[model samples]
Target: MKLQKAPQAAPELVHLEALLGKASVTPLDAGCQPYLAERLEELGFIVERLPCQGVDNLIARRPGVPSLAFAGHTDVVPAGQHWQVPPFQLSELGGYLYGRGIADMKGGIAAFLVAVERALATGHELPGLMLLLTSDEEGEAEFGSRVMAQHLKTQGLLPPWVLVGEPTARSHSGDTLRVGRRGAVSGTLRLSGRAGHVAYLPPTANLLHRALALGQQLAALEWDSGAPDFPGTVLHVTGLEHGDWLDNVTPSSATLRFNLRYSHKTSKDAIDQRIRALVPGDLDFQLDWDRPCEPYFSLFGEAQPNFLTRVERAVFKGLGQFPVLSTAGGASDGRFFSALGCEVIELGLPNASIHQANERVEKGEYLRLIDIYQALLESL
Candidate 1:
């Protein structure tokens, strides 16, 4: 079934479609930079560059009172082997549009630029609406919008309300407004033991076994039963290293790398305490509070009902369903925005194939997203 769009919405949408035609695959947003900057400048935005190594970030805005910011990335994960249509070339295959980043979020960058541009063209005061685009998101993200957010905050550049264009859609609902997200805490647990031949019966315990036990405990520990607007926190063990390449030699040490997507309820100190308590001594263990970031909650207790009310009404009218206020997922630049206490929410196209080849979004749904974004701009 096709999603419907009004005739008046066709023109600007064609522009979005054309931009997707230009492939902005990661590290090489190749032809995408000038096009975006030109479009924003054409719309009378004051655009600036946040220079990084090879890729660059963009900050664009139309001046207003209480500032507003929309953030998203231009980088697409490398395309794999799923091409009914060329991943770099945009095409309407079936009812969906096929292309890398169409959903994971070229769709967002396209819609907001057009909606905000249209709104500004209306000549009504918007109390300050802005948009920022970064190219380092799909990579290590060491130099993307997060860095921009920090820079903005230091210079008092943070805005009043911020929306991150992360695809937050599910089967039952068209979109969900992400009010909060669990904070990601990660660490390297190193255990040391005596190096010896496998046949040598040493009194020393196997550091590998100790590290494995520690990993099990850390993996089982619960971070939270979910925060006010988010889901139960999740802990995942990403790396386990031991048995040095020389298998027969009882390697002196083993390492485990793990991460916790913890809710705001559990602070880093508390989480660390629980971890260290589980270790058995003479095990020679090393722990790092490698929490480069902390989990954050929105101004989202019952205390901020009005804020959610405004967003729910907007989501209801915009997408025909009230957004489920949520805080589940990997960390995003939203974490940085939240630090400065911006009323943050993330919404975008259905994440059908965000970081993959032949990535695509339904043409119908893509068009509908513009209407949704337009509705949000109109309401806010």
Candidate 2:
């Protein structure tokens, strides 16, 4: 790829470059949120800093009806060893901006801000508009968008629609738009048995042997045939643990940790019941469940045609491209809004370099995203 200097530094890149200079790796704001808050305040937004635990969140709102919220995270994953350019320093290489979070997020945030800036400058009337930013999205995420969502709900300020800049596009900036996400549920299975020497005959116990059989049963059990809008509910045994290995002794207990990414067709209780049924009657066991995100689709079944139609039109007008509406991806903050009865969609730069070494996004795509966001904001 031949590198070319961009015509000039676009306003959005100026902001992104400033953000990329900050060392705000996951769970740390690195003063990025405060910097953004100041800029938003200057744009006539009511900015509020909401800090939960060590994670910083910022909510900036403008008065109007029919609310539209733009959500993004300022955090970037830790940069691994290989990088032609410093991960924290924004550099243009091969007409692409190289930096962590540029593709995964910060670029999206910068674009949205620029969109708002241009819209206001053009004297365009915007409906209730807001930005929800968190530093916890790339980390444990318990205190980030999750906390902000709860707070918004309490204040009766939850937006009717939300746009999350989560790098959903594949081949091009507007090629893919994530309209839904799968839910993730995890469980730990503890199987117990009497401990005894393997060589001794009196009272021998083999928890590993029993566990293997139970695991096979669970693995073979059919969860669900994927629905049209979502993939099948699948489960995988992520880890297996047992006591120290000994030539002549059998471990007394075994533990298996399994996780499942499921759709709305299944429930935690239903999955729990299936596991209980698969357990052998003679074995003593316990199953514990933890659910992080719930499945949601904004344009599935008898869903909102008007809202999605507007979004489609905006994409066409902004990028001269028709985006593919999809639900294929891991969990994101979009789920929180979906749970709050708000329509959520994710759109951003191509994700080929997201979370990878020398992560970068096309400078052209970054500019196009700002235009897309601006058009989407106008349509809303």
Candidate 3:
């Protein structure tokens, strides 16, 4: 079979920008949810909607065998203040597209979709291709991709490979790929305390002071020196709340919530045990945690050779160098897919203004990502 030279840029990428012009806030809403669904159907793929709590997700498949899935989220992080252009509307100033989800993900989805369409038009058939769009990736994601993944598993339709289109580009917005991510464990801690007057504290330690001490101990307790794929296990006192801070009265109760970005080197139970070991024996404290997902390594012997080569070719063609292969940073939905034993890797337009005010992407980089996606499809 003859392979046609890859296009310098996907022309359809711009049309993709227009399609996602309707933006959804957190979970899926009427404005963007239905709009995305219609667009996917128009692309000639069989689509499924797995209703997620309040949000909805889209799963479109071009049927065959041993599938390759391109997964991403459509709902954007709240567009915070810091915009010279409207966050929802597209602006082409300085050759960059400024919008809420432009870089973090909307650009990713557009590029992948255009690649799929281009491959189809050029008679470049894939084993099977799927575009999985969820609305709750930036939210709790309690009911979005997790739900669809479960359904696919039950139906024996989970794809063999997954490419999560999370922007991993550093400095600029191209040439980065993330193949591994650390795990996340989050919960609240509350230590019960007895009320007492500040001036008349007698035989007991003040509840507020005890709680503060416990928090200090928890934070100071070393989690791990550091791990191979993830940074050292560390704890952050994200939220500290007290019912009262009065001068005369001691607090009766206090609560705090913290998160742990951990690695596969340790289990949640082990981390919990470490926390328990750091607390005072007299204080009554509660620890609650849920293992959202464990980290996975996708770079291995045989498969990685082909995948990485294709990825690097596209990266070099678009952004001029192999991006830094670093894993000590933000978590991704790709981490979840990797844990499920699929070959998961993420590469997309540069991540310049992700999860920040007026997230933007270089329009040129967006099209470049499409070329990369198409190249990956051909090489894979």
- Which candidate number would show the highest lDDT if scored against the true structure? 2
State the C-alpha lDDT per candidate.
0.72, 0.84, 0.72
* lDDT (tens digit, per residue) of candidate 1 on 104-216: 77878887777776676676445567777888777777777777888777867678778788888763224677777777778777877777676774535556666777788
Candidates sorted by lDDT, best first: 2, 3, 1
**TM-score, prediction 1:** 0.84
Steric collisions counted per model: 4, 0, 2
- Candidate 2's C-alpha runs over 4 A off are 1-9, 197-205, 300-305
lDDT of 3 by residue, 179-261 (tens): 77777788677888788877889636877777777778777776664555546666788888888578689888888778888
Error of 1 at 132 (Å): 0.9
Please give, for residues 274-364, the per-residue lDDT of candidate 2 as tens digits: 8888887888998898756778878532554466676777788877879898889888988888888888889898999999998999888
| TM-scores for every candidate against the unseen true structure | 0.84, 0.92, 0.83
Candidate 1: which stretches are off by over 4 Å?
Answer: 1-10, 121-123, 171-174, 196-209, 219-222, 234-241, 244-251, 267-270, 288-294, 300-307
Of 1 and 2, the candidate ranking higher by TM-score: 2
Measured on C-alpha atoms, candidate 1 has an lDDT of 0.72
